[model samples]
Target: MISGVTLLDYRERYSTKVYFQKRFFTVYIPFLFWSIFILFYSLILGRISISDLSFASIIDGIINSKFLSFYWFFMPLFAIYLSIPIISLIPKNKRKTIFEYIIGVFFVFNSFLPLVFNLLKIPYNSSLYIPVLGGYIIWIFIGYYLDRFDLNNKSRKIIYILGILGLLLQIVGTWFFSYQNGYVDQMFKGYNNLPSWLYSSAFFLFIKENYHKLNFKGILSKLISLCEKETFGVYLIQYYLMEFFILVLHFDPYSISYRLGASVLIFFLSVFIVKILHKIPIIQKLC
Candidate 1:
């Protein structure tokens, strides 16, 4: 929603090409620089030798390897940004209909296509397509639509009810699916799931409704403002920060308390690191 608001305002103030170009630079340049840093850092740390640093290997690390597991987020986000110009050219009245159809198709693909492939014994690779067609794209359109149109009170209440139900569905479905799959991981609760779609819609609506009620002032407000500013940096660096606690400090991954504490520690550490990084001119753009 925030991105939607900002992009819409930019569209009003600037040419479409200029806005698209600026948005591309702000995100992609940072991503490319970060990926390059990862490659060099791996070389320096002896994780990869000159022979292993082939063009294909470097590209795979940036695009698919577990060394940069979190970078998958950047790929779909970039795809969404790339689609903005095309979506903008779409007629306003037709956008919701088109988005609904696309999301519905992809949602089914994410949730059921794998099962169908398994049943048919077809060798299908989800990784090849899920990032581009997954349900996260639905939320991007939702954000844009919500920014463009307000929900009526009745609609909000209905969404709130559905959200609660969705949360329940997610919790129950996780347990059920885990048992059926003979694994403990809640893989069914992926970002592309129906439960996530419902829950996220509800959660966002709840926040939107309640946001103005809370008096955000003094230290609390300032802290929130800082977090908002540092969020992209936190996202960029958080995987490594969290991993340090697990790898170096040897925090037990199975312990909820340890994981929670590590998260809190990483959050503050990431914020501080981002603050310092922000002071530098070129690096500032990435953070």
Candidate 2:
């Protein structure tokens, strides 16, 4: 969604330096602040001992997002942001064809072929290496393509149905494999996989198609805008709030009821905290 939204507002004439500067302050600064904050919070909660702390370890934690598992998202997100200027440099007339070819390559090699190899129990070792064309960057192009083009009703319906099937595969496949292994299987649960791509694409299209039909007005719209502004800040801090619930409050997140309640509470609490932080001039920029 971030990539799609960014593309919506992007212009080739925009200054790369200014764009990077804004992202550095708005995204990276908050990431750094929360990384350190979470590290200290974990320490205070006895999640890690004093001996585990070192300058090197701290740097590694921030760089690799080892402090909080969810923080790993920032690294790829920043990478994508860094690539946007280059992405924007693609010739306007040739962008559609180039994006299509690249997306197809990503689908075949990075997603489809890997799944096929894994399912067949094949020892997959590809000599063909295209690091820049692989990983979550595909999503960036996918988002751009989907936003730029309109799908007909038939196409949308097919995509929606496939998305439903993809979701079912993730749920059922994971449960089956996990039951056999006696542990949760993460194989079916990553964004880079086909199932996730289908599910996410369908969801994105659904929102894009129907958004105009929905009524958002007055205070409701303002509230929605406020929430949108706080989203990144909330994401940066929400993991620690969840950890506090699990570790300090002993909330069992595995329980459906507890999960729902905790999620709502954490969301509102994080929003409130971010809202308060936004009042402070310097602190607001960091978060």
Candidate 3:
């Protein structure tokens, strides 16, 4: 197999010199930038807002709220994107496949579950903490599968077909189950829209396989490269900044379009901030 901008190989993790693998950088970078606007808009507009206080209410509200329902969906994907690099930091001896690293990340976050369960005064499922952590677990694995398309062409074709079929089945199943009430009351609602997991999974798999074969090393590639490199800083500040903006704009988050716009604005802002902070000795850790 051809070496893709050799960095810290899984077999030889944590080398003296740090380098980004070409496999991940180009695709991840552009996707991250695109996600900011897409996810934010969905959050603010796609689903209804989480009512808090009850796990049931949040799930229900998310299903009802256009933007809020979408927010729950984003949690799984974006959280995973945020965590990949951190997981890569683990020693090679201790780590195995990217899936193992993802589990480790989940366990690290899951460690806090006992505390969250005890401290939070709410009904069952009121504690939505574990799911967010689980989201990280899901994405990193997706990245691994994406970066290394070892699967044969036939296998990939089959997988894509199955993913689509599974989603279609899921839609039918959910629709049937949802008739119990006037509406479905779970954050895990809707389908055939932007950021569809089944479609994204298929697309990522397809890209991973053909990425090297494609023309990705040009100006557009460099632009994406920057986003991938700056993503950690972007992740660190995005949600915090989003919250801040919510207060500043005095705008209710239920507006999906505004939140989407804010996410796009924040994506560029994060890159500029990272450039400045890289100069500072101490603040680097915060980003």
Choose the strongest candidate by lDDT. Answer: 2
Q: Could you give candidate 3's per-residue lDDT for residues 65-166 as a string of tens digits?
A: 332232344444444434545655766555446455544444344433333343363333535445544533544444454564366778678769856765
| Selected candidate, larger TM-score, 1 vs 3 | 1
Per-residue lDDT tens digits of candidate 1, residues 1-287? 45544563455578887976787677888888887777777788788788866777778888774456678878777766766665566676787677667656665666556544644779658674555554355666666665566778897888789778878987886788788888874544667666676778788776666765553655556778878788888888887777778888888867987767777878989999999999999789987
Looking at model 2, which ten-residue stretch has the lowest summed lDDT? Answer: 4-13
Candidate 3 residue spans exceeding 4 A from truth: 1-146, 166-184, 187-200, 212-219
Estimate the lDDT of model 2: 0.81
lDDT of 1 at 90: 62
lDDT tens digits by residue: candidate 2, 111-211: 77777787788966775535777558888887888787777889889989988998998999999989999999876788988789888988888777777
Count clashing residue pairs in model 3. Answer: 15
Clashes of each: 0, 0, 15
Query: Where does candidate 2 stray beyond 4 Å?
Result: 7-9, 128-130, 216-223
The TM-score of predicted model 1 comes to 0.81
Give the candidate order by descending lDDT: 2, 1, 3
Of 2 and 3, which scores higher on lDDT? Answer: 2
State every prediction's TM-score relative to the real structure: 0.81, 0.91, 0.46
Worst 10 residues of 1 by lDDT: 1-10
RMSD of candidates 1 onward, in order: 4.2, 2.2, 12.9
